[model samples]
Target chain A: MNDVIITAIQQTLIEGNVETAETAARAALEAGVDAQTILNEGLMRGADIVGQQFEAGEVFLPQLMFTARALKAAMAIITPELKRLSAESGISSSKGRVVLATIQSDIHDIGKNIVSTMLTTGGFEVIDLGVDVPIKRIISTALDEGADIIGCSAMLTTSMPFMSDLIKTLEAMGQRERFKVMIGGASVTPAYAERIGADGTAANAVQALQLARQFMQNALA
Target chain B: MDYLEIIDRSDSGEYISEENWDLEKVAMTCMRLVSQYDLKWDRQNLVPDDPALADRVFAAGLALAVEIGAYNRSSERILRFERDELESALRDMKQTLSMGQGADERVLFARQIEDSRPPLVWAGNPGAPHPEALFLPAVVSWAQEPIVDLITCGTLAEVDGREVRTGEALEITATRRELTYLHQALAHVGRPGMGMLAAQSSVSELGDLAAANPDYLRTCDAHLVPMLNELKIDNRNIARAVNSIEYGMRNGGLYCAISGGLGGDAPGCALISVASMILGLLTNRADYHILHPIHIRHVATSTREVLWVESVVLQAFARNAPAIIVTDVYPKSGALTRELLYETAANALAITVSGGHLEGCGSADGLVPHATGLEPRLMGEVGHAACRQGVTRAQANQWILQLMEKYEHVFRMPEGNPGARFDQAYDLETLQPLPEWTRMYEEVKTELKEMGLDLSG
Candidate 1:
């Protein structure tokens, strides 16, 4: 019965039926299915399929966005139960916490949003600070959230200096080693990333997810 | 509709969150229309020779414009438009635009598929960043090209060695200095009266407002009022139009629809491009429009998918609306390489044969200051040669496929083909191409000639 409910949740989420996904999550919880099992088997599995489809070019941004919405809906219903279980069992399920933002004065967010969705699907808890975010707010939010990675995006060359500034500011605050900094955007290059002292850069969202995973593994090491 | 009506409607229209507008109104609506029109993107034909497909794309685009309308980011409302209003705007849009004054004056008119007339070359390294020292020489490089009808410029990465931040007071200084350099460069080339699509330093309306003078950006020049991704606009762009209306500068509405973004693939992007153009006529009060469809991954128009999007969008506008459209040619490969020329030739052929004026050789995807006049020279050369030979869609597609084989591999590489910076490609003292760069250009020209693109004209 639990397997049937989990499959139904995955199907609804993959189909991007948000309300139905939320209903499935509630039903799973009512049927005494562990919140962690629903998240691992249903929500995460659905998101993984959507992400795989997006990477394969079989689906596009709208479908990815719709599935993300459905996942968000389902997560909202399951998060409280998961938190209760974590407190009782003393085991967290998240891969890692990440803070994402488009650097100051750059209003372009499509790329950043794509990375955010991909990261969320990868099981990282993402705190997405929307477009035109200042350096101070980003650092403060990362510190506050205990984030493992701080991802910045800049679509304009004018705003790209802020990414460098972010690194310099972190170094000045003696917090440079605290969080991993990864930058990507139309204007960002790997050379610029190295020049700015960023941990790494990615060409697209899939590479960004891989880079984030690599960063987390390094942190563990 | 006037700018006042646009503002009023922005504030008074039905409220919708930006996310909802993007997903539901823009994405969902485009998918429905794509299905309704049965618009399938033919990957093999980068430039389709089907008039029926063009008409269907136009109808779907018009329906999209009427259904989705423009979303106002500042007001968080939908700037609704009746079909009649959009149609009337399209009907009233200027079919011909007069730019510049005196000897360098040029009139840009609506072009048709297989247009016999040589498409005008608006050359420059548009929106690319340039150091202050290289800015003047970069503009002069293109201005000295005899085939270039008008010139555009990149943004100054620094002013007096200080970084220029957008929306800050320094932006005004940067914009004015950029124009001053542009004016100096044009006079240096004795094309002082040449029109320009400039003010790229203006990341916001402040710089645009500061540059509105006879000394800098003149009434004869044009500045961009860009639409955000998909079908969205903010007050900064509206303020640009409002400033240009009374100032009498030409407003170029820039719609850069992403290939794999909200509007799915090539066909969906083409439909969004058409709808964005129609809405831009009403909201941006644009005299002319720029079709710059960039790939979501590559961010370059020279990509196969982007070239297809540009081709179809240009054809749709040329066959149906007949508006003055300029297509941007941004190649992933930069200067001092044969790949840049091949990419330029491919883009020039596709755009020229599909009824659009050419505007760039924004090298290295316009990400870095890796552009020079040599590629734009090749762009003009290929464009004129294509017209002179009366290249067809089929022939152009074949040539484009050949050219893509030369440079499309760069898109897959981890570090893209950022060939060389301007300083490396040109002799700084004379602002002329070095032997190595010129040799590459000559070689590419010979190869393209062998492929039947006669550059003898």
Candidate 2:
């Protein structure tokens, strides 16, 4: 019965039916299926398939976005249960925490938001700082939240220099070692990331998740 | 109505989230319409040879425009248009624009596919960031190129050692400085009355407004007002559009639609691009449209998918509307290399055969200060050569696919090369390509000739 409910949740997410996915989440929880199992075996499993399909070009961005939205809805239903379970068991459950933002002087943020959605669905906690964010604010928030990684995006060639400025500021503050900095956008290159002293860089959301995961693994080790 | 009325309408439209408008409405609408029209991209043919396919794509784009409309980020609204309004805008749009005066005078008009008239070259280091000190030399490099018909120089990376701020005094000063440098460059080349595109340094309306007068930017000159990607526009853009009209300047709307963005793939990007050109005409009262379908994965327009997108979008405009169309060739490779030449040649060929007047030489994808005269000179040269070859759309598509294979590997480079800087690629005093860069250019021309592309003018 629990397996049936979990599969229903997973299939609903894959279908990108947000309402049905939400309902399936509640049904699974009511059926006494554990929160982690639902998230791992159901939503994340569905998300993994969606990500693969997207990578393969079988599904375009809109379908990916719809699937992401459905997964977000399912997560909303299961998150409180996750917190309660963690509190009862005296353990925290999350891959890592990420802070994402589109750097200053550029208002383009669709790519940043997509990365945020991907990171969130991939089980990492994400704090999106939105667009036109200054360098100081990004560092302060990352420090305050004890974020595991900082992802910066800038779409305009005019605004690409801010990523370099961010690294310089982080180094000057002597707190550069505390966080992993990743830079990307349409104009950003992997060499730019290295020149700007970022820990890593990614071209898209899927690669970003891989970078974040690698950073987290290195941090934990 | 006029610009202010359009602004008011933009402000009064239905409120929606930026995500829903860009991701849901634009994406889903374009995708479903693609399916409804039975529009399937032929991976083998980058440029569609069939007239019916081009019409179907345009029809789907028009349908999507009517259904989804454009979003206004500042007002949090959807700037919906009526069929009659769009029709009237199309019917009344000035089909031809005479830019500049005297010996440098040129006419920009709506073009059909395989239009025999030579594609006008609007050459410059568009959007490439440059040191304030190197600005004049760089501007002169582009202006002095005899093949270049129009000019729009690169933006000054700094003014008095500080980054340019939007709506600030720096914007005004920098814009004036940009025009001064452009004027100086033109006079240096003795093409003093050359038609130029201006105000690229402007971060807001202040620069355009401050520079819109005849002294800085002339009535014959054009000013750029870009529609933010995924069909979003702001008050600053609106103000610039209106300001240009008031000053009798041509309002040029720049739209760079991205794949994996609002548009899903080549087909989706083409559809969204068509809708964007129409909306740009109605909303900005634009005299010409610069349509660039950029691929997000490589940040370069020389790839197979981007070339396909560019061809189809330009063909759609060519076949349907009698509107002035200008497209850009953003080479992923930096200047002074054989790779840059090959990429520029392929991109230039695609723009020429698919019916777009080329407007670029964005070396290193406009990231580095590495742009030089030779690549743009090559763009015009190769474009004119392609035009003379009587290249068919199918032939251009096949050649483009083969050509992309030569330089697409560069996209895999980790730090996209800022390429060789201006000083490295050109002689500053003479504004000519250095010997090594000249050698590379000659060698690539031969290589292109060997590949069956006619380079002889």
Candidate 3:
């Protein structure tokens, strides 16, 4: 019966049916399925399928966004239950926390938003600072939230210098060793990433996920 | 509708959060219209020769424009428009406009599908980044091309060896220096009266406002007022339009609809492109339009899907409401490579035959400073040759397919076709193509001729 409810939740998420996804999560919870099992076996599975479809070019941004929305809906219901379980057992359940922003003076956020959605669905806790975000605010927020990584996006060449400034500021504050910094966007090249001392850069959202995961692994190591 | 009314509506119109506006209003509405209009993108037919399909796309686009309108990012409101207002704006648009002064002056006109007249060649490495040292010679390269009727240029990556940061004092300096170099380059090339689409140094309204002097961006030259992704606009571009309109300079509404973004696939992107153009007619008060549909993944306009989107959008406007449309020829590959020439040729053939004047060689996808004058020269040659041969949509499609086969592999590569930088491709002193680059151009020209383009003329 629990397996049936979990499959329903997964199917609803894959179909991007927000209301049904929420209702399915409620049903799973009422049926006594643990929050972690529902998340890992159902929501994450659906998101993984959607992400794969997006990477394969079988689906596009809208589908990815809709699926992410469905995941958000389901996560909203399951988060408190998972928090309760975490408090009881003293175990944290998250891949890693990522703070994302489009650098200052760059109002382009489509790429950043896409990355945020992918990170959320890929099991990372994402705090999106939105576009035209100042480096100071991004650093303060990441420090406040204890984020594991900072992903900065800049589509304009003028805004790219701020990424360097972000690293410099972190180093000045003696916090460069605390978080992994990744940079990307239309104008950001791998060479620019190396020049600015970014931990890594990715060409697209799929690769961005891989890069972020690698950063987390290296952090653990 | 008054321009002030557009601004007032932006403040007072129906409110929707930006997220809801993007997904529900823009994306869902586009998907509904795509189905309602029975529009389907045929991958095999990148340049569809169907007039009825074009008309359907225009109707769907007009409906979309009325439904969603333009979202104001500042106010988070929809700048709603009545169908009559949009129609009136399109009807009253300038059918012909003259650019430049004296012997260099040229008249831009609305082009019909397969129009016999040779399309005006507006050449440049538009929006690409260039070091300060290369800026002057790069502009001169495009200006000196005898086949180029007008010119455009890239932005300066630096000023006096210092990096340019937006919203700073250096923005003003960079913008002014850009125009000064442009002016000097045109005069140095003996085409002092040549018109330009410039002010690329303007990352915001600050640089544009600073460059409004006659010595900088003249009334004769034009500047871009870009619409954000999908159907969104902000105060920065609004300020640019207001400044240019009051200052008497021309405004080119730049709509770069992402192929796989809000609008899905080629047909949906065409729909969004048409709607954006209609809104731009009122919002930007544009004298002309630049169709620059880029792939969401590749970010280049020369892809097969983007070419199809460009063809359909241009055809829709040409058939329904004729306007002066210039297609940006941003290819994936850069200079010193046959792939760049092939991409340029395919883009030129597709756009020129589909009622779009040429403006590009934003090579290497406009990311690197990997562009030079030779690619724009090839763009003009291919565009004029296609017109001279009177190639039909079918013939252009066939040639484009052959050309795509030669370069499409690069898009799949991880390194992404970063061919060669400007300094490596051209001689700094003479501002001429290097030997190897010229050889690649000649070889590509020969191959294109064998494919039935009349290059001899």
Candidate 4:
């Protein structure tokens, strides 16, 4: 209920711990705090601080892991509470939905996970499909979830063909225009993304969030 | 203070004095790497003359140099290949070929065959020669299986002894040299430049390698070894090395490159390979190009642990640098077979494409007295074709899985004639393909193309 949640979240993000952060979140929820309040005020605020630390190099990968764990734990407790609050308030108009998955044939899930966390912090509904996903399942999931944006992750040069093939599959299924596509990973160059024909490609997590928001806005316009 | 800080003291914690230009911090770090890895530090023992285990060990390491070097270099984009689908695909591919099962090498064009299409060289310790002029022939010649790119230009030799990097002086020289070389090299090769990489080297040595009179090159590459070692690894040395790369780029400017060289070894150190690459990246010359030369590991099955250590270091490096990654492409064992060669190339390709841009060295056997007569050109041919794959790292890696299927069992030894002078592959001087071997090369090429590799282009 106190800054302990905030400090713990901060510590957890960098250290990549999911367990202890989960404990902290459960405790925060038991403290009678509103779910939305913990999410925006406690969880997200903690992630933002950790993001800056990473930016400043005050902390590195180990610290970021802990931070992610803390955030995930806090988000777990707040999801139900937020739903309940929305129902109680009879509110509407939340952020759009995003389907995030690491493409099939590639098991590199770290980049996708980081991007998913960033998208969640942006308040978008992120549905992460994990790594090494087949093209068919991704297309099916996007259609079923009614996702507005589809983010495909590939970290291998060998696996890049999957990205192109996934797009081709979406096009074949007549669902290509239904969702915006985003591609990313370390070996992914802008030239490659353009060559492969993804609607958008981000270099890193921060860039992913910016592009995602922009894509949705453009669609609306 | 850290190591850099400690090195800074040599320069009085200021700039490198004019007297101490061209030293390298990477070379300094080489000492520690050798001690840690417990590897021998000489290339001469490439062929042991005695029964000494140390001599044999050096020969083993040299053999590995061919394995790693000629094996289809790559080590960037590792994340893409780190998937279950890719891993499973390789597992399945290895199972298909009865010979697959070894820690030494394999070819990989992708994480999965489903993802493995062609026109992409995922891993080929490719040549990125400076001077864009080499493009037409470079590309044409490179159209073969393993050769991948032609880095048009990079850093030059020297500028006011400060090892000129990132300035107008470097640019002027690079552009001029590139124009001169491109016009001539292309004229002979007959192709326009398609893909170019950054040039790297000392501009001061422009007049030197231009003196590529075999005698001069031999001197620069070998004789000047002692002086290069004297500069000890430090920031100034790093700067000098960076500047020299800048000079190499200048000589072959506008070709696109990430700078580094082969001399990053401590005068006599076993870890020269890693040191050379680390020095190249630390210079903040990411914009121009990228350079990474994976440390060599011995081919001896007894030394598998040593090889892994080098691989892990390269894995870390793959995440750190942005430029294309180049690693060894051969397996290093004298017992290598054509099938095993393909498999090792495939495995090395898998690691390279996933990890980074690979250089397919065709590091086919050479240097040994009997290891001769094994065609180095075929090695180059495989390199050129494999490099053009452009497939995903995981898919490219799958090719290694395919190769391991046929070659892993032979990592230690395979087959040989009763009167064989050497164990398996031959040395450089004797590198010639018997008609049967030539036919085998043709057969492999056709088969790879059938797999959708599209090497004919």
Candidate 5:
């Protein structure tokens, strides 16, 4: 029965059929599978494969976006039950919480949105601060939310200096070690990120999710 | 009828949710219209050589304008235009834009497909980062070139020993300084009245507002009011357009549409590019349009796929609207290299033969400050040669294929080391390209002549 449910979820997400994915989630609940099990074995399993194909170039942006939409639909149907199960068992659903924003003076957010989508699907809770975000707002939110990581994006080369400024601000507050800093964008490179004192840098959304997971593991270690 | 009317309409239009405008309505509607029109691309000929196909793309682009309109990100609404309004704008749009005053003035007019006229050349460091000291030198480097008709400039990485933050007071000061340096550069070149494409230092509307004065950016100069990528706009751009129009300045639209993002692929991008051109007309009331379709991966338009889109879109506007279109040449490689020259030749050749004016070949994807005046001169040289030879679409396709074979392998490679800065590429004392850079340019021009371009005039 678990195998059937997993296959149903996988096929629905692969096809990007949102209604069918939602229906599959409901059916799995009716068939006596626990919500955590369903989330881990069914929804997450399907999303993980899609993310893999995307990174491998077997799937393109349009296909990955569609699959993400379908997975969101399935997660919507299963979220409440997962919350109930977590409340009863005293456990968490996500790996760690992250706060992401596009740095100030530039309003391009395609990369940020992609990273948020991939991170959320990879079992991390994400607080998206949208585009052209100021330095104080980003730092304060990360502290207030107890964020495990703060990722910033700047597509223009002019806005790239802001990432350096953000890292400096965190240091000035003496809260630098509390959260991992990740920077990525079209104009940003790994060398630039390291020079700016970023803990991690991702070239694309798939790599970003992997970097987030590594940050979480390091925190636990 | 004017920019104020458009601004008021953008603010007062029916409010829709951002979700519907960005995700659900825009892309889905564009996809549906693309399929319905049965538009397809020919990879061999980057610009569609067929007149009928060009007309079809134009019609489809107009249909898209009437359907999707332009989404206003600030207002959360779509600014719709009547068919009559669009038609009138097309019918009465300026054919020739007189840039600059008196002895330094140049006229930018429309070109038809295979038109034998020399396309206008506008050159400068287009938003590339420069050290405070190098900014003026870079402007002089581009303006001192005899072939360059207009000037744009790079921005200073720091002003007054501090970073120039956007939407801050420093932005206004930096922009004013940019124009001042430009005025000085023109005076140095003995063309004191040369027109400039203004506000290259402005990252927001505040910078533009500060520089809109007569001394900094004159009414005769062109102001670049850009549309956000993939059919979106904000209040900053709207304000720039409204202010420019009200001040009797000629506002032009500068749009860089992502190929793989909303446009889907090469063909979809071509359609979207056409739609973006029309959107510029309706929203900004632009005097001229600059179409830039960039690859999401390489962040340039030098690839054969992108060249084809540039060709077809130019033909669409040329054959249908009489709209003056200026195409951008964004190479993946940095300047002062053989690969950069080849990419520049291919991009310039395609634009010249397709009846589109060339804006620049500089700054290497706008990621580095590696551009000098030499590449833009080479661009003008090659462009003039193509126009004189009356190059056709078939001949251009063959030449470009040969050109791409030289550099497309490393098109996606990362720039491990930084590109050469302005000081390294040019001599600031003489405002001339370095000896090595000039040799490389001459060598590439000779190589082009050997490749049957015969640029030896």
Candidate 6:
């Protein structure tokens, strides 16, 4: 059982095939292996390999999409088992909800997809509103979904200013305190993030996950 | 393989070109010297500066002329019109133009190549003097006749934020004007020239430029596609041609191109990286030139490692691509001194002589189209000598080592102070150059001349 679970986890991580990873998780549960070990070893490890492949240029957008799909596949298979296990043990709780969108007037979604994949792995349920979403709609979604945080992605130099506008609009709406805004993209630098008054900034997908977690924790505290 | 079939067949993916001509016959019958002479052939017999190779190139051009028989369609590489043929074709095309004759295919073909020749650097608003324009006298002086290695007509924008004034016209009208400017500027430069194209400032979208100016797309041979139609053909905003497909031409303005330089290159990756980069260039040959645009300043390890690795990469890419490549070099800090200039020139020359085609001279990044002067000329000397100096790898290495030294100091300076742009950095006429500066250009030129660089010739 341990061997099957771990090998599936290993294959998921290394080969980036999420369905196999999911199958491994399901099989492990049936064989009485701990569900937590399956996910912690399988899904997270799968993500790390994808990130590495992305950085190494061994995987570009198309490959990244496949890995993300695989990760989702594995996660879908493991979710109920992991949840049942957590419910039985009484250790799991809702981590919080995050909303992600490529900011207004920019259509680039590739980077946004990478960040979303990582965030999902980090235990947040994300609602992606897609690209060219206007500021009012983003703020409204935050309010409507009772989201814990909002992540904005703008891939163009011309369009990134709207991220700041979103924040400013939140302030004008007098609900700035209700949301934690984090920005990511190729054109938006850390200095720019700071100048725009974003709560935090992310350079790549890995940083995005780390920043989201940190921002959520600090906001709660 | 009729490469044109590659474009013609839309749905038949992966079919051996339906035209069924053996690859060499099509390559030879057409004037794609880059394709015909490219690494597929025996490179041992060819050299760019070698009179024989250039002659072979000319012969290839003539063969294409013979194959086509008459100027009925635009040629790919063959500029076969003889003095008589050119006159007849030119007369007939002009007659067509005057009489509104039915589709001057010969003229259309000639115009296609002419249009493809690097958009003459359109120096927009040349009539108004830019403080930057002050250096033009020295630049033109240095560039006349044999010194004109290749010129892309330069343009300057009068921009107010995101909007350029040119954007005021109907998007399509402005585009036609922009295309007209390209054609007009090509005529203005007045020689069988090189293309350095311009964009119609920033408009809403690429299509708007055409939609606003339908006249820009007014060519009768093809209705679905008009304007520049090779593939991946692009006009650099400055000179940093972005992304591979953009290099290949995302819009209609493009003839296909392969991106050069490593946007995400890491150390020890040069040989493999450059080898792959060259492969991408050849996969599409009409527009993309297989040149390594090298830079050391950006991250992915250290500068020296980047430069050294890129040198090897450039040599390999140029050798394998068997095509013209432009090498990008960064200018270092400090005053514009001749020693520093030549040192950089020498380094560039070494790589280029190893068989790089065009050279992106001096601080070749976001700072492209930097008041063009000494850098390109100095770089050209080394590039010229590259073909002449070393046929063997080791000889080219030694020659580049000698050249790379003079310009290493350039990197040390505060960013943007390329020695060639000294006029902008400081008043060149008023602020006298340091003694070492005066001798540097002379010394390097003399040495390059000795190395068989024909700067004048």
Q: Work out the TM-score per prediction.
A: 0.96, 0.92, 0.98, 0.37, 0.94, 0.53
Residue B41 CA displacement from its true place in model 3, Å: 1.3
**B395: Cα error in model 2, Å:** 2.4
Q: Report lDDT per candidate.
A: 0.91, 0.82, 0.90, 0.42, 0.81, 0.44
lDDT of 4 at A11: 55
* Of candidates 3 and 1, the better by DockQ: 3
Task: Give lDDT tens digits, candidate 5, residues A1-221.
Answer: 78888789888877767899899989998998888887888877887887787665455455556667788888889889888888988887878899999998888877787788788778888898888999899999999999999999997666778889999999999999999999999767778888889998987888899999999888778
Runs in model 2 lying further than 4 Å from the true structure: A1-8, A55-58, A97-99, A134-150, A157-182, A186-203, A214-221, B165-169, B416-418
Off by over 4 Å in 3: none
Badly placed stretches (over 4 Å) of model 6 are A1-4, A49-66, A83-156, A184-187, B1-158, B161-195, B203-378, B390-457
Order the candidates by DockQ, highest first — what do you get? 3, 1, 5, 2, 6, 4
Interface RMSD of 4: 18.4
Instruction: Give lDDT tens digits, candidate 2, residues B153-221.
Output: 788767889876554577788889889888998999999999998878886677888898888999999
Q: How high is the DockQ of candidate 3?
A: 0.79
Put down candidate 4 lDDT per residue, A1-221, tens digits, no spaces.
Answer: 36666566545544545676676667767876556666666666667776666545354333444455456565675677778788889752345789998877555554676677677656678888866678788888889989999998875444566788888888888878898989997446677778877888886677898899899789778
How far residue A168's Cα lies from its native spot in candidate 6, in Å, is: 3.6
On DockQ, who's better, 2 or 6?
2
For model 2, residues A1-221, the per-residue Cα lDDT tens digits are: 88788788878978888899999999898888999999999998888888788776677667677888898888899999999999999766688899899998778887897788778768788898888898899999999999989999987666777788888899999999989999888767777788778998898899999999899889778
Docking class of 4: incorrect
Give the alpha carbon lDDT tens digit for every residue of B1-457 in model 3. 7679878988898999888998999889999999999999787788999999999999999999999899989888899999899999999988998899999999999999999898899988777888998888877877898999999889987999899988888889999999999999989989989888998988888999999999999999999998898899987788889999999999999999988888887778889999999999888878999999989888888888999999988899999999999999999898788999999999998899999999998999888888888888989998898888899999999989988889999889888888888889899988899999999888989999888898997
Give stretches of model 4 more than 4 Å off: A1-19, A56-58, A90-96, A104-110, A120-126, A130-132, A155-162, A186-197, A216-221, B1-136, B139-457
Model 2 alpha-carbon miss at residue A16, Å: 2.8
Worst 10 residues of 3 chain A by lDDT: A54-63
Residue range B194-230, candidate 4, lDDT tens digits: 2332222322233333433322121111101101221
Off by over 4 Å in 1: A1-7, A30-32, A139-148, A167-178, A218-221
Residue-wise lDDT of candidate 5 within B343-410, one digit each (tens)?
88999999998889988765577667888888888888888888888888888889898888887876
Highest TM-score among the candidates is held by which one? 3
Instruction: Estimate, for each residue in A48-110, the C-alpha lDDT of model 1 and write its tens digit.
Output: 998998988788888888888888899899999999999999978788899999999888989
Q: Cα deviation in Å at residue B43, candidate 4?
A: 29
Please compute the TM-score of chain B alone for each predicted structure, in the order given. Answer: 0.99, 0.97, 0.99, 0.40, 0.97, 0.47
